[model samples]
Structure formats: C-alpha cells, structure tokens
Target chain A: TQLLEQSPQFLSIQEGENLTVYCNSSSVFSSLQWYRQEPGEGPVLLVTVVTGGEVKKLKRLTFQFGDARKDSSLHITAAQPGDTGLYLCAGPFNFGNEKLTFGTGTRLTIIP
Target chain B: GAGVSQTPSNKVTEKGKYVELRCDPISGHTALYWYRQSLGQGPEFLIYFQGTGAADDSGLPNDRFFAVRPEGSVSTLKIQRTERGDSAVYLCASSLSLAGATQYFGPGTRLTVL
Candidate 1:
C-alpha cells in the first residue's frame, strides 16, 4: 500500500501566525490534492498540484509540490480563524488508477 | 450547479444492524466515489463508479460493505451486520471525470455503530 505521511498532526496558533503543513511519501503520484475540512462538514478541495516542482497560490494559501512528486506542502500566511480546519493531502496510489489514498491529516486551529 | 450531496448527516445504530446511506452526485458528473474517514485519519476510499458501473471497489474492507450507483447519478452504500468498528464519517465525492480530476465532496454521514 502506498502511504503518505503528514507532519504536525495538530497545530494551534494565534491569528496572524504563519504555519506550514507537510505531506510526504516515498512513492510518486500522478497528482497531489489538498483539502480543508471543517468540523461537521465535508472536506473542501483547496488545491491540486500535478507537476513536480509546481507551485500554486490561492489568496493567503501557497501550495508546493516536491521535485520528485513524492511530497507536497501547504503554507498559510497570516492565518485567520476561518482558516482553522483539518488539512489533508491525497493522490492516486497508482497511475491510471481511479482510487485515491489519503494521508493522515493536519488539524490547524487559529485562535483570535 | 449544486455540489455532491449525501443524506442523513448523522446515523446512530446498534451493532448487527443494517444501514443504507445515500448519495447524489453533481448533475453532470460522471464519476463518483465513496470514502470512510475515521477519527484523526484522512478519508479512505471505499469505491469508485464511472457511470452506472463500479470501476474500482478494491478499497472496500469486506463483503458486508456494498455500494451501487444506478443510472449513473445516485449511489447507495449498504452495510449489513454493521460492527462498532464501522462507525465513521462516510464521504461522497463526484468529479467531472475520474480520480485524476478535482473532486467535490459532500458533508458526509457520521455513522455511529454502537
């Protein structure tokens, strides 16, 4: 089984602090996706990084993919209370495969 | 367009009971997926449907978990003789294409098997 590991399982920071969540794996994936899930709600897709060494930004959130496609990271700047949620990284275990394997999540809490 | 949606946001049942959870994908989405998320873990894929047929069901943990997507739009996940370990959040997602594309997820059904 392909395994993706995430660091900093839980983070609680005051508003305006910056934090980065890491998702790593030994195996490469065709695509990497990041999702944010709030309590009692389904996960919402935050970004998808497809190419190795790719970088994408969504407002205050920045996402980066490893040069080998085996890892990815999500960096949040000036985090707000609205940004507090569980962040997850997911990708297909195999190329041309339809099933995705998700990494253990990173839960972030931004205190005002 | 509306996003993928699942019914019964929460379900509490005793062990050995049978339960069926429902899902409705986006209006034009052709690919749908089911996943189970345990506490402190990410959502684990259970099945994938392309159109009306299951393209991949290898993620299903056991035979007691069965899912069907009839007519390529609505799907149902049925669990028979549910065990306490089966308690988790059941998530439904739909993509414009397959797993390679961006998938929209539903709020999920929190199944609690006591």
Candidate 2:
C-alpha cells in the first residue's frame, strides 16, 4: 500500500505567524494536490503540483512539490484566523488509475 | 447541480442496520469517486466510477460496502449491518475526467453508527 505521511498533526499559532506542513511518501506519484477543509465540510482544492520541484502560490499559501515527486509541502505566511482548518495532501498512482491516496492530514488553528 | 451534492448531511443509525448515502455529481462529469473520513484523519478512497462502471473498488474495507452509479450521474453507497467503525463522513467527488483533473467535492454525509 502507498502511504503518505504528514508531519505536525496539530498546529496552533497566533495570527501573523508563519508555518509549514510536510507530506512525504516513499512511492513516486504522477501528481499531487493540496486541500483545505473546514469543520463539517468537504475539502476544497487549493492547488495542484504535477511536476517535480514545482512551486505554486495562492495568496498567503505556497505549495511545493519535491524534486522526486514523492513529497510536498504547504507553507502559510502571515496566517490569520481564516487559515485555520484541516490540510490534506493527495496524489494519484502511476498506473493510470483514478484512485487517489491521501495523507493523514494536519489540523491548523490560528488564534487571533 | 452547481457542484457535487450529497443527501442526508448527517445520519445516525443503530448498529446492524442498513444505510444508503447518495451523491449527485456535476453535470457532464464522467468520473465519480467515494471516500470516507474518520475523525481527525484525511479522506480514504472507497471507490471510483468511470461512467456507470466501477473502475476501481480496491479501497473498500469489506464486502459490506457496495456502491453503484446506475445512470452515471448519481451514485449511491450502501452499507449493510453497519458497525461502529463505519461512523465517519462519506464524501463524494467528481471530475471531468480522472486523468490529471481536479476533483470537485461535495459537503459529505456524516454517518454515525451507534
């Protein structure tokens, strides 16, 4: 089974703080995506990184794909209360299948 | 619908009972997916449907779980003899195609098996 492990399962920081979350896997993936989910809601896609060593920024959120395509990172700059939520990383396998494997997740709480 | 829609935002049922969760994918989306998320964890893929056929169902934990997309637009997930472990949020998502396409997710149905 392919497993994606995420670090810092729970994070709590004051507003305006900067934090980073990491997702790592031993198996290579064809593409990776980042999502943010609020309480009692499905996750919303933030960004998708398909190429190795690729970086994409969305407002205060920056996502980076590892050079090997086996890992990814999400960094939030000057975080606010709105940034508080559960973050998840997902990737599809290389066999042309539609199934996606998701990481455990990171719950972030930004206190104002 | 504007996006994927799931019925019964929250369902509470007793153990050994049967439950069905419904999902309505976006119009023209050919690929639909089902996932389960336990508290404090990310969503785990349960099944994938390409049109009316199940392309992949390896993620299903047991035979008690079954899903069908009869018309390719709406899908249903049925769980028989529900167990406490079946308590979680069942999410449905759809994409134009699964090949490198972003999936649009529904609000999900929270099923609590007591």
Tens-digit lDDT track of model 1 for A56-98? 9999999999999999999999999999899999998666786
Stretches of candidate 2 above 4 Å error? none
Give per-residue lDDT, candidate 1, residue A38.
93
lDDT by residue for model 2 (B1-114), tens:
598899999999999999999999999999999999999999999999999999899889999999999998999999999999999999999998746788889999999999
Q: Per-prediction DockQ, in order?
A: 0.77, 0.80
Quality of model 1 by C-alpha lDDT: 0.93
Could you say which candidate leads in lDDT? 2
Worst ten in a row by lDDT for model 2 chain A: A92-101
Model 2 DockQ class: medium
TM-score of chain A for each candidate? Answer: 0.96, 0.97
After superposition, the stretches of candidate 1 with alpha carbons farther than 4 Å from their true spots are none
